[model samples]
Target: MSDRRDVWITGIGLVSSLGEGLEAHWTALSTPAKPAVDETTYAPYVLHPLAKIDFDQQIPKRGDQRQMEPWQRIGTYAAGLALDSAGLKGNKEVLATTDMVVAAGGGERDQTVDGAILTDIEKQPNPEVFLSEQLQSNLRPTLFLAQLSNLLAGNISIVHGVTGSSRTFMGEESSGTDAVRIGWSRIAAGTSEIALVGGAYNAERRDMLLLFALKSVALHSPWAPVLADPKGVPTGSAGAFLVLESPEHAMARGAKPIAKLSGVWSERAKRGEPGAIEALVDEMIRTAKGDVSEGTAILSAACGAPEPTSAEVAAISRSGLPVRSVTDRVGHSLEAQMPVALALAALAVSKGKLFAPLEGETLEEAFEGTLTRAIVTGVGHWRGEGVALVERVD
Candidate 1:
């Protein structure tokens, strides 16, 4: 049957504002971080908790650390953990055949101008002093390479010697899910044996902070009602990835199945559409492998917005599956949310526990039904896409 080609999530690695690793991220999301104002000296934007990976331990001894942006570092760290989780450290064949895919909203856009050089060119107060300061500021002629969105995938391929297809997807907040969908399509069509698909985002730059400050999306107080306030958008970094393998390959290699990506569906939100979520969710349920009545729970990408959240609720009411808002714990991780939500679903099925929700957060009663299957929904910004994936454990 067509369902025989199962896409199993074999490993997961995550880094977020909460901390490193899956446990730390889970804890950080579960327990809110203290608030800070935007444009802090140490790092821009203090109101929302920032997810950052410690770069000190990962930098090369003699390489130019400044050349690597924070987004690159985050991607590298998370990819390493994902490979480790998948037990591919020393596997030559897997490394040779594996495909690398990066899903992100938009890559970093931080550029620093040499103050000393500009001052010297302008010939400030004291020529001798200006020249001395400029010379002291590393006057070596070095090539400057602008970081591209594809650099993350390129670097990953170079490090791992993955000569297979290397690509990236940019879908605003839905990029992570879109990347996985691409990876899954490749594996399903017998393109590659294994795929590394996830997303990484860093909001530590001045421009990103200023943008947030201008939008007023950054939560001013940790005590702010994130759910109640349509403006409570937390700014944090997250790298959520999954190592997907075909069912036949996994079973042949004696690898246990974590959870199956039974189906992935997406749709663009039309302007002025009132029931976009309902339409997309209904389509997914109608086309699901298993009956919609068997669906027990749903992991939704509500994005903490009132309209989208209400739309999700209204959709679940029609699907008749209990829905759990995963974004509540992980925040709105943009492109990284796809793999993050998938990882959470895998954990729930692998551990055989109905994952708990934060206090005072209640899903609609219709989705609260007792069943063995669940659907996870993800929605991006106003013009972004809506993605849904179905998972079941009996």
Candidate 2:
């Protein structure tokens, strides 16, 4: 650890229900505003739909755009924004070696095909044969290809020209945490100079709704702040990407550091055991909290699931830091949750102040002091736990 180089966040691209771009998110979070939610579309479940986006600005090719699904398009566009923000958009020299780490889930299911198969399969004589036939004939060849989780990274490479090594992690919220951690670790260890890391999720799909419904973790009609609500997670559509580079590399390119990614710690707690999450969160926070005195707060990605949210709340209480839940504003973007929180944390440290409390004054109190450091905490709705430290670059 002592030999590690300082990793810096040189660029951030975030697109969510609040809006697109850094300025838009800052304006929305800093002001008194309600989260943009759609309660009727997937009733009685609620979700935060993506704000209007102009994909043309990022992915200009019509053929390229047509081939990708909504999630891929979102990720590719966000990656472009990060490259632009880092001053590497057209710099083929730099992009050719810019490694990428992506956190992704399988592609959206074809609900029409799924429904038809279900309806007809029940009446067929040989269910196995009928099912096999339906799968081959009903599903398009391109759909299977689109479902590969690594396509997000491949599209980003093709669209943005980031030709370095590519790695994709798939495991909901934990994948997002590891994507950032791996990228940071590689740069700090001197194995890589720069990396692009993040994830994207599209929440407006019946198949996903059903999947979460099976777990009984889907939020319902009466929406509430994440910390206050015990009703499950209300997923959101979002894409977040960060450009991470070593301090020396950034300086050599004249790229300004948005904030310093000092440390990132990740763990998977055995949720079946009581207090596992709380213990891991406590230890991780203490470890990542090294030497910081004042002007610090926490940006938490506590999805509204009962157990994990409760455990995270208890941990945050013990830390005594002014904490705000990212889920309260953006809804729970499973794979993008951690990256989104880190991006906002970095943005806050750079701006020297934390945004206003997301909900009522009780759970999220106002932070009036100058912000020099921000701790981003992510307690997965079910499994993973992670803590990341983002500090001002002096």
Candidate 3:
């Protein structure tokens, strides 16, 4: 049971509150990053549960780091590691052959000041200056290219000397999976040889933090026995990237592949309850090779929603795979879900281990593990954007 459209993931990179670089993040996620105590009053969202690199410790050189916004910094760092993993470095072959596609729920958050725009506006002496001034004043540099959804792609192309098609798509919650789909499409279409694809979002922003706090969507306690309160869900930022290349291309380049994207499917429900994820999950398994019932471990996209969590559990119930939730360690990263989850799943495969959620966690009862298959479920609210199913074949 093989298909010619196989997309192999030769490389992966992650920048999250859990840590930076693949190894650091891999270690942090396997361990736990739970906060010491529950302190809901002190702006509960200000910090992340765990991160191996002291962000400040990895200071960016004056100019290199200064130009990037905080959120953008996380993504750029992650992209660097991903390329490194692919053994593509800042080399000419990768630059010449790769096209890029980035996905995100929301573009970069602009923190740039208007000093430059204001100065330019002030320089105009014409009466129309005021009108143009108003428009220019609105342009802020800190957030400038750094905030653009396609900024990283543009930067990557420039840095790597890539001249292929580069673009960004907004898939709300499905951005991560969609990014992979698009990359796959391009590769299949012969539009590009290698595709750099992924998504990133900084959920720790003061506004986003406050918003989640008000929504009471985050778990007060992120570890085991997460309080039943709906408000207990925690959120964090992550940048995860995967280099998708045709099997032929990767083998030609002598790339050591981690997993092959054997199949990708997507769908949207006209109207339904939160558990609509069941159908999506079912499709991924039905199309996968071999028995979907044994030794399968599910890496769920449980963003702390009981309905969707139950929905995915029901789907996996049929396939009979052990379900594991990594969000417990990495926090809820909306756009970064696919790459991060897949990366962790790949690591688990590499190490021959299954990650257990915190004790007394609700996910323990949902999966079935025998010895033949490993299925990781990634569920999210596309909020009407749609859902995608990505199969990782070893």
All predictions: root-mean-square deviation over Cα? 7.0, 2.2, 6.7
Global lDDT of model 1: 0.61
For each candidate, the alpha-carbon lDDT, in order, equals 0.61, 0.89, 0.59
Q: Is candidate 1 or candidate 2 better by lDDT?
A: 2
Q: Lowest summed lDDT over 10 consecutive residues: which window, candidate 1?
A: 30-39
Lowest lDDT sum, 10 consecutive residues, model 3, at: 222-231
Q: Which runs in model 2 stand beyond 4 Å of their true positions?
A: 117-143, 291-293
C-alpha lDDT (0 to 100) for residue 315 of candidate 2: 88
Two-way TM-score contest, 2 vs 3, winner: 2
lDDT of 1 by residue, 313-345 (tens): 566556655556665555666777777777776
Candidate 2 lDDT tens digits, 245-326: 9999999999999999998888999888999999999888878776675898988888888889889888887887888778
Q: What TM-score would candidate 3 get against the native? A: 0.77
TM-score of 1: 0.77
Task: Provide the clash count, candidate 1.
Answer: 9
TM-score of each: 0.77, 0.94, 0.77
Question: Number of the top candidate by lDDT?
Answer: 2
Best candidate (score: TM-score): 2
Tens-digit lDDT string for candidate 3 (83-102)? 88888886786667687777
